[model samples]
Target: MNTTILDMVKIEVTKLLAVGIIYPISDSHWVSLVQVVPKKYGMTVMRNQHDELVPMRIQNSWQATRKDHFPLPFVDQILEKLARKSHYYFLDGFFGYMKIYIAPEDQHKTTFICPFGTFAYTHMPFDLCNTPSTFQRCMTSIFLDLL
Candidate 1:
């Protein structure tokens, strides 16, 4: 609402755009509204190379998007599989979700509007309802040989 907050939002958006994480989208049928919160407390969010919080889009498209119901292995199942393994590999996906690319035709579904401008995600954002399954599928493919 105030000029001070508006400036901060603009700065964040500019940074994301420069990094190719988001692109200016003038028209999107699925445009979602943007709200500037002090932090990304609950949802999956990220920080740029400078460690500043990047602008994140919050869309309700998850309510309609088809879920990729890839069941995650239960802990006991995982333990059973690894019980006698000679070695184990652990990967931290702290920022891995952001590395997953979003399809060009579907990027608009993640679009959001703000005082600065309208934009859409170029990579998978973790808040999506299907993100967990999508990420799991990706990890499964990458670790298929290991498994």
Candidate 2:
């Protein structure tokens, strides 16, 4: 594959928001140009600087198979325990805007390839193994006194 062409196509799609068109150039070769869209679902393929292929959103396929057995408190239980409270302070943006950093050495594990180029995430992404558990662990550590 002519990766240069693929890279250029990716850049146009991502940076320029251009629409992609596919055409069969030869009996054995087909060329496709695509536009990058905000991901609601599905997977994207990207390359790293090492010219490796990384597939994004592949976690969607395995998400259904993951089991949650972490020792997290149930919401109902917390509510029951706090029933005697006179006033309650509701905290907004508890987990909504939290940022988790990824270790530099492990950032490569989060690398993904796009038609334009390969990139790595500097922060923890939503779609990763044990993400919920990891987040829960962090939240627990932060709110240990409250919990």
Candidate 3:
């Protein structure tokens, strides 16, 4: 069964709510929110005051008053929070290795076992951060790559 992107979004949204990790990152200034999903994946979806979802490229630095990024620490917290449930949530991300898996002595790789194999974008969202005409052009280029 193939899950749509909307399905992914909804699942993530619900999981965040259940863990009580859903909070606006900045109450009066930065205007960002963090959603901590247990088990599967961790994503940060930004939004405006109107509650419209804004797409964001992943960043290297922590955005606010946190000692670490929300998703990383949140996973640990969620693990502790749901320790009794043997098969509780696990966290996955879009790219690179999560620091959570690194050993103190052998900190070389961040290899996570993905049942779905690698996470390459065969067809990325064309409308993301682009005008209609530009999106159409990108679509054409993508199609060319397919061939």
Candidate 4:
């Protein structure tokens, strides 16, 4: 990482730490490698204060997580269900997955190591192998009646 990006990472780490999103850890058996990724919009200028969000990832640990084979609705099925619908209400749950908290007993499994320090997530991040299915199940459960 270059000096500019490193500084940004430190700043981001400090912010997350202060907000109780991540906590420093001395050690863990399931530490993940941290990575920096640009958001979908991508970074336009490196110096931009609003630079894309950095996705802290568990590159190798992903292989270690058990896959949640929860079935999600197929796109064709969904479109068929709404074929004649006149009204549509799209739910934008972007970042909503973050609301799913990791159980206290299992939070340690999400530990990640970075240059700044070692830490763990308090909630489910996007990179988890089962995140999609897990998040889908959670959303479906919450909106069971509506769906």
Which candidate wins on lDDT?
1
lDDT of 3 by residue, 101-129 (tens): 22223211111111222111112221122
**What is the lDDT ranking, best to worst?**
1, 4, 2, 3
Q: Tell me the lDDT of model 2 at 84.
A: 75
Best by TM-score: 4
Error of 1 at 134 (Å): 0.9
Q: Which regions of candidate 1 fall more than 4 Å away from where they truly are?
A: 1-8, 36-64, 75-90
- Taking the tens digit of each residue's C-alpha lDDT, what string does model 2 give over 1-147? 366555554553464223211111222111122333223464343233433222223344653224555776688987986897776665433232226666766555554444444445455544455556667777778878976
Scanning candidate 1 in windows of ten residues, the lowest lDDT window is: 44-53
* Candidate 1, 80-125: lDDT as tens digits: 9888898887666646887999999888888767777888999877
**Which residue runs does candidate 3 get wrong by more than 4 Å?**
1-3, 24-28, 32-147
RMSD of each: 6.8, 12.1, 20.5, 6.1
TM-score of each: 0.66, 0.45, 0.21, 0.73
**C-alpha lDDT of candidate 4 relative to the true structure:** 0.69
Clash-forming residue pairs, model 2: 10-116, 20-33, 45-113, 46-113, 46-114, 47-113, 47-118
lDDT of residue 61 for candidate 2: 68
After superposition of all CA atoms, the RMSD between model 4 and the true structure is 6.1
Residue 136 error, candidate 2, Å: 1.1
The candidate, 1 or 4, that scores higher on lDDT is 1
lDDT of 4 at 37: 53
What value does the lDDT take at residue 138 in candidate 1? Answer: 92
